[model samples]
Target: MEKVMMILAAFVLTSTSRPPEHKYVYVDELKNWTEAQRFCRQTYTDLATLESQQDVEALSDMATSVRKTSELAWIGLYDDVNSWRWSTSDSDFYQHEEMDFNNWQAGKPNNVWLGLFRDSWKWVEGKNFSFRFWNEGNNEPGNNGKEECAAAHFGRSGQWEDWPCDQHKAFVCYSELCGNASLPGRKYFFVGELKTWTEAQSHCREHYGNLAVMENMEDVGTLNNMAASLGFTSTAWIGLYDDVNSWRWSVSEYDLDQHQENKFTNWQPSEPNNDAGRESCIEMFANGSWNDITCSKLQGSICSEVRDSDVKFTFINVDMNWTQAQSYCRNHYTDLARVRNMTDIQKIQTLIPAGQNVWIGFHRPFWMWVDGSRFSFSYWRSSEPSGSGEHCASADLGNSGQWENWDCDGQRPFICYNVVCGNSTLPTREYIIVDELKTWTEAQRYCRENHKDLATITNMEDVRMLNDLATGRTSQAWIGLHEDVNSWRWSMSDQYQNQFRNWAAGQPNNKFGRESCGALSADGSWYDVSCSQTLHTVCFNVCGTNPTFYYSSTKRSWTEAQSFCREHYRDLAGVRHLSDNKVIQGLVQRAAWMGLYRDSWKWADGGNSSFRNWNRDEPNHNGKEGCAAANFGNAGKWEDWSCGEKKAFVCYAAVQSKHLVKLQLEFPSSLTEDDSAMMEELLIKLKQKLKDDGVKGDVKVSWRKRPDGKILHKPKKKKDEL
Candidate 1:
């Protein structure tokens, strides 16, 4: 395919006047010529065989084209089929050069015979400074011993010669330029020395009205022509940036057409990632089109500016870890724009930019909203909260980016929307609307075809202020919740509908496909639609949760008398945060570890409480420090630290389905009738299983015990013997 492509490219130059529009296909840089050719054919095309002067001119912009005015490229010309002819020898277009391109470097055409191989001449010049070539098996040039050999050329100036297939050198990447003309209306082009996007943009604007923008191969060809005129080599930049998943034009306003389709496109694998969440810029040259690039890089760039409108605002990664929201805003937007008021949000609805997501200044408490409003509301998903002391809110401009309250000091990537707001509202139910470029369905699709679920209303206050707040949206948003399939369950149960749903009248009918999605009501209920229907929606996922009795337990050594938690009731559950501790403590009747110590009586659960809410100071250690247990009926069943007591100790493990996953499923029964309810069953099983599984136990040597409970053949038994 590579050979065929190059030939076709040659034919195109012979037939047209346009310069070559080639996009270099990168290969393993370590590849030799033969392997490189296979890779190109498999990736870009065959080794480049220049067939036209225009092709020659266009190739001038590429550094790897490797035509040194004399060095001959290995085209699809071989006599392997017993016929020595150029692969594409039809059309009588072969160059009748004034000098042979197959240069013979100092007797390089000599064929030497050695060993058992048949006698023949080799292309060995016999010196390191001089090039040599041969057929190893028969020590001959040309194809012999059923082996393949190739002819080399030094163009018209150097001597003609032959070479062994094993020699290594750089090869050319060519495409069938005769295919469909390149896509058109691209918004940026590369020029001169590589420059960072900002520098390039500035330079481009000063020169050819912003770097050339190309959306198609024809446009690429035109740029190629432009580059040929200016003399550039190697890869350069285009206007694409990684907004998120793929590359999109940086100055999207200048975009006139979309990208074109080409079979010879190249990709450097797993690229175009904008995952640090902030990088939304794009670049060219990893095989072809545009792939996302890191914004911090100083790569070559192409800029675009149409005659009708001027694009301002440059994107830059700041130099400090101490970037303030206000500083970021001042640097990007004008004068720390008053906390993104409703009007601003509405205006931003329309200009969703090409690719980027960021938090606006509306989040307060973290930062003072100049509007002098009390920090009273929230729009959090389940477990919505405030006062971890974070008062700032980041709004997602792309709808795909969600709105969230973040720590004031947290570092995050941000986007600056061109549409100004905090001013007025648009007169449409749809403040801003964008299509869902990627196909999706109701349950699967985000509220906005381009964004996530929907808009949210924190409290009745926000809802009342919403029509005014959502300067762009008069209608309510579709929350993430609704009846999925047949059940009337929200997609995320955590995001329960706040009191401010604006469902259309008589909505959310649970009839079959009717209640598949969530559409806010003008009054109360939500309207459900077919899960496949694509519609706009909004959500507010806001609610406040106070610190409460969220409880969980951990492992502690125990015995048979108590079930896990109740053993250290006073010590473990001792109302540390007095309020929360007491809150759940009332419900726990059985005594459990109050996370306390009895010997030192130190609280085991770990806290700074010096006072133990003990039951009348009853933690009297009876010499042997056993575990503690309390009678719930006893007043303040607390404060007990007996580590060795035997009780039906409750051991906790995560429950899967209804059963806990255990290392050893089967337990062994012990013969010690006095051992109280087979207490060692689990331990014995673990030891035996570990042995069987080749897991060694502490290898301390021990003696066998006699039936009479005495050590066998031992002089004296140690007091601490097990």
Candidate 2:
């Protein structure tokens, strides 16, 4: 193999992820999952779409350094195929060229669909050491046996490179393949011997269409089993793809009814997501089940109709939260979850590891149907939520073949499933937001009416997350709690729970008559407010991490604070209105009068240093005195200090440790537990640090009304987050 030099090793996987509307870049230099999604949305766009093999190829060529050991970059759809539709528009056409110009700054497609095909990762060449992308688990890197997505690229000038499919690198995903290459159409009847999937797709496309598109479960089954019977293990192309659009099947007039089952078609459990138009093709897993995955995902697949029903879908052994599991099933399986028989249970058993019990469709959080029918009061192996408010429940196959009651609010573990297992299909469920805004009584009403309860918060992260959403607001909404007719009961039902009461100050004391609700507030605090007050509350939907590192520019001698902020912080902190500036202007005046001088009492970005007290009649610099600083003393007494003057600096860094921001978001990972523990330490340390540094007078830390109402110690439930 002839290798050319000159390619920069420092690869940059650039992508234009579409946020709610704007486009964002990954900036891999410093990004974690949460912040990465935030940056994509709040800053740029949502994420890049890797819809086709060509798109994957382009991205690999565009990305960099896939020397066989690179991290598998995330694309749009591993989670659920149905939800696999593009984040932007699920419309039929995606203008590929229009994307070339809109690609985000770089390193995007940060988030990925959470699907893990059985351990078969697509590498550059061989297996094992050759694996380029490294998925967190046996999650399908490449859908079928052959892995294609293992190939990723960075930079616009390098050669397309391949890596281990599981590698975790930022990647570029294209919506469609922009090229002149087009396959012609034709007809065939298995002339004599069998054909490799690749060969079949190529020949088929050249004659019968660009790869066959399987329409339904029957169609997929009809094809894969045929290939397996033929003893084919190679890869094949399929008409099913999401690039440009999802519905435009790769092949023309691809029909299933016209063709009869040819003795070899078959499918695995819950096959064919057709999610957002995903891997509509078939690739038999080593275990004989059919994995309907992403075409670009690159796996060893075969052509022809599926013919096997005995093929059980294999589950990728990956750990996921209940909400995540639900989401995954919806995307890939086209439903919530199913519980048909013991085999289905065994199939699901493959998802989580031993010692971990997760929530499945058999949960009875609110009401349980007696043989799929009504409000039957049923108690399980476990007792009620005696102490801690446990809202969600799970199956405890650990003991008797019955369900066990655990706190769904706890977020322990979860599993996803497909159909071929012959289990009944999953049902639909509309959630009641535990983190939504609602009054105590109002929240209870909403929960009772719906098939849910006021969302119960279970962890510190949830408390902090809820608070983040309720920031700048007053009055906390209610969480699922209250004195239900004299007893401390959960709105969902009386399930067995271990922990309880997370109240702030004299909380849940049945204030003013009786306390009937609990709520989380802004600032990671939990509390019990009066049931009558109106405030935003949150609901748990079950969800999901990562932080990016940021280092600000050191010194530029900005003449104006606004400019200084503009050059730094990426932009200015909330300015509000000019009236606010008027109040600040007075401080500039005093600073100028205090023996401080620049060309004039200039601002940091070079404007009239109208701070402190405008040295009598100021504005003499004609807005040129742009350096503004607070007087050495006085709360708002600002001054125009020289840009060259060196003073104690306040450096801003990207809050790399959201879970540990209170520890000053330190670089030392082992410093503290997380926000719940360190927040108290931070408050104490910040006060002490400020006092010792003498900045107490210069800079003050104003305490805002704690939204959660709880003191720094009380934690919350994880399910109560947005």
Candidate 3:
């Protein structure tokens, strides 16, 4: 192994060079954030993604000649709040590193609702009432893998179980006490008469009062006793019906104040009898007393006028219904009179004829009882009423007891009650779960009718108690934890894992809890802003050897700019490095958008860079600002802004460099220029050697051809030898 080896040296010549890292372009077209992004991507690489002061300066210089001074241009920096966060937002509840705790199963949180079990349950009506009566024998909720609805079984002493929502079962409906115990003496009567809801209403009005308006739990108890006495264990019609058209005032502005003055009514001793179940409009007598009347009834209207902030009334002797009167008043005067206070009534009373009733501005409520009682008490099952076309209400007397909206034309047994001019009282009842398989909504109705409501868990102790209650029944049960789809998330799906942040002082404050976007400042800080603000935008292009940036002097909103960048370039510039911040900062003449936005906070590109540069107390999260912009006037810091704001933008593109490399080498005497294959082999070896020497990127090596259309020519003999 220690043998001496003869060595031969070969003469060679070589030259090499490299291209610049990136190139920038400045466009002077005036477009929105999105429009500018499109132009840049189509004409150049993409919106500029700055990475250093030099890069910013180059862009600035290029733009200075064509763009106005102090003008904001789009940049490739934005805000993204779409990141992973806990469902629990209470900061104090989590200790150090606890907020990051995770016990997810392998390949869990896969962004889809699969066969996983939910941590909690909820009532159909979304109430977190602390009560549990689950049938634990069969693992009740189990969601049964697909069962989302809950039901109570009377056979199980009111214990609950889960089932599919579409399952048909008898249900229960209940009404609250009217609270007005002085409204004459009312008694419930079971009409065993099978009629459509409409026909039933007509029959009830003609015979008793209106189909028994159960206004309270006492009323419910009364009806239950009556049904039990008659052994009528079946579904039946009730007076409560869906009045799809919501009540409103002729003046839209007054509608906003309706809630505050909802209790203000000047009914003339039960004047709103709702005769024939068709009275849905309001009328005022000369004495200022109000009455419910059919909307189709023709009558004179009282119009109001606003003069010097004081309302005045004008009576029009036109015979028109509520709708026509409203239009007429709006065209001729301000609008139908709105009785805000006693003063308004007095003013309108003076204009009314001695015994005439004039139309007023009030309309009927969405839900109404045939007896003209206030529709205050409700016991709707979870996601019930369908809200599609079902207008009539029905009570399930045999199954998971609950209230539901039904078709008015559907025939069913009915319950009717009469007023007997005497006071009456009812007794209390105990909770009893119905024994029937029905939807969660249906179960809720049954519970509300027979008991109080579905169980609502508030704490772990409640959970334990519920578990104990369901010990021998179903294992899973419904509680009251509705899933909210609205949460912090990133716009770019792939960049969700990024945790980098750069906030300005007091930024991301989520002021008013509306801010959800991110922004960049001139000083290289970050901020939380709105997504609708218009600003300059930045884009990036990585199609070349290296990332390059460009500046579009057009203004656009954050989203529009994003669409433009993604459509043409790689995406909005994602500055995951301090170097990138510096580069972007230098180019900023004004605040611009970047790829640092968030539904929670993420970059436009799916980069894992975690670099950040924030000003003190940044990301205040003020307003509904959900987009990110870079403020150049403040030293290229970041601030959240409305994405709809139009401003200039920046984009970037990638480029490749070519170098004319030359090399000379001495070979053995036996090797000749005609050995083209050997020369190619040598070039390949040279390329490999360069790679081994730490050279990156694409490298090519080839022999240079001479004027004689040949390469690797033999060297000429020395002058002395000649």
- In terms of lDDT, the best-performing candidate is 3
Ranking by lDDT: 3, 1, 2
lDDT of 2: 0.30
Candidate 1 C-alpha lDDT tens digits along 35-85: 555645643445554434443334333422221322333422222221112
Number of the top candidate by TM-score? 3
**Model 2 C-alpha lDDT per residue in residues 183-231, reported as the tens digit of each score:** 1111112212234333433433222212332223333343334444544
Is 2 or 3 the stronger prediction by lDDT? 3
How well does candidate 1 score on lDDT at residue 181? 44
What Cα-based lDDT does every candidate model obtain?
0.30, 0.30, 0.55
Kindly list the per-residue Cα lDDT of model 3 for residues 184-272, writing each as its tens digit.
45655555657999788766644444576666555666566656655667888988876644454555443332335533668799566
Give Cα distance to truth, residue 15, candidate 1, Å: 12
